[model samples]
Target: MAVEAPFWFTSLAGLGAVYLSVVFLRLLPYLVLYLRQPKDLRRCYGSWAVITGPTTGLGRSMAMELARLGFNLVLLDLHPDNLREVSDTIREAHSVQTKTVVFDLSLVGTEKGDEAMRRLREAVEGVDVGMLVNNAAVAKPGALYFHEADVERLVTMIRVNAMALTEVTAAVLPGMVKRGRGAIVNVGSGSTVAVPSFPLYTVYSSSKRYVEQLSSSLYVEYKSKGIDVQLQVPFYVHTNMLSSAVKERMLLPAFVATADDYTRAAVRWIGHGPIAVPVAGQQLQWFLAAVVPEFAHNWYRLRKHLQHRAILWNLN
Candidate 1:
């Protein structure tokens, strides 16, 4: 005769079984999705790429990598110094033709911003831009609550992250459509998926969410037209965008992909098709966030908030 287990032990064992079953059930769809790599992104060498926020982080790294891959570059940024450095580096290192446009994308529609884009358009008027990277972004820290947040900054964030990307896409799209080929790579954040409780970056994340959604809708609209619009979702990267304290806390155990890593993966996959998640592990995280139960997802978000706080405190 078999010995009967204690009630508490039996209950714990049953709970563990249920948890494991839920995890496996959630993972099955991702496993299938991950195994099937889309075929269109394999050949992207020699394409012309226009990269916004091209002076630092993922944007800068992408400009360099694309140049190395034999693509001509149109680099846009607010800082002329950094833009010059990046252009010179790419020109010397890869011998690829490079153009630098210095303009505050957040200020678009203003006399200065409009002039900048107009000048950029004139500079590259006839040149075919095979890819447009909408990667520039900004955030104001410490104001975690809505009431405390800077309205001006929020407006600026929307202008740059949402409006500018839209305008730049519009500026380049007619030519791309007329030519019947091109790609638009919009850089989005994982925060949009996790929906961080940090109110300071609320506007920033919201804008990114808009980009991701718009990119997807545009992809569907233009698929038959031969224009691939890709949404590149990335998690926390070691960039100037985050505070030092936040960076220390947000850095994951998994490879904190450098801008170069992101750029390479992004450019390669952009050619494959629309909607590429550059980081592998984080892609799973995104998938789970998308399909998971709302309550469960909110619980996970709460845990993330706590984790972010803990990381910030530890840094201090």
Candidate 2:
């Protein structure tokens, strides 16, 4: 026996689905706040800049660049040894004041997390923190087959990527707002521009998208108050985080942007404008992905898979 649905009921359900879809689509781009705008956080040059994930990769690069620009730094990382090494390097090379706080950002928001932030604030008391870079992130390779991967890894990713960022921003924003000047730069990925075929990256990408969106909304809300929020979306660079295959795929003409190249561009654009895309050429890819028809985009992604057997292949 075939059970037929009532016409009115089916129509209403379909309409609801369509409405939800439209709302999500409208909110998607701004969802990740993945672009960083320029703002003069250096209003107090030689002042303090707080950087998370500062021991390596893009975060380390940003720290060094800021040091060169005459900003003292408070560097945070999970690895104490690496943090000490980086702190020593910056202090010696740049001859600037530096502080190293070694703690796992992923651990900071639990019952013990609140105490940690309090301690951090107390330690940096009276030091004007003018810039905050939320750049620490971790990714477990391959597709997101939930059952296959350790759930704890995903939990940590969310904690560091989303929870820690929110907590740190909340901790420092009041000071910036009170002073009527400050810059918050959140590092994100170009992958948020489109859904990747890689399974496990879904959680990581979603978390980044959350950061981007939060940054955008915060910018809108705080710009008049003199708080500058910038979200940076960059393609893959040479970082220890990626596997060799991933590195090779990222270096393709379309997808590659070196850490130094992107960081220099980002710093130059800081305090100069509202948002900055370090690699302007990469912006074209984002535009294409956003504007192209869904069918065509899917076809493009499929073609890349066929052309190269790589799990993640750049369009270039």
Please name the candidate that would achieve the greatest TM-score relative to the true structure. Answer: 1
Instruction: Give candidate 2's error at residue 172 in angstroms.
Output: 1.0
TM-score of 1: 0.80
lDDT of 2 by residue, 265-316 (tens): 7775554434556665565556546656777755665564344334533422
| CA lDDT for candidate 2 | 0.73
* Candidate 1 residue-wise lDDT at 267: 60
Give one digit per residue, the lDDT tens place, for model 1 in 191-288.
77554333345687888889989998999998888888888888767777766676665566474767676666666566455666766666656655
TM-scores for all candidates: the values are 0.80, 0.78
Off by over 4 Å in 1: 1-46, 194-200, 288-293, 299-316
Candidate 1 at residue 116, lDDT? Answer: 87
- Per-model C-alpha RMSD: 4.8, 10.8
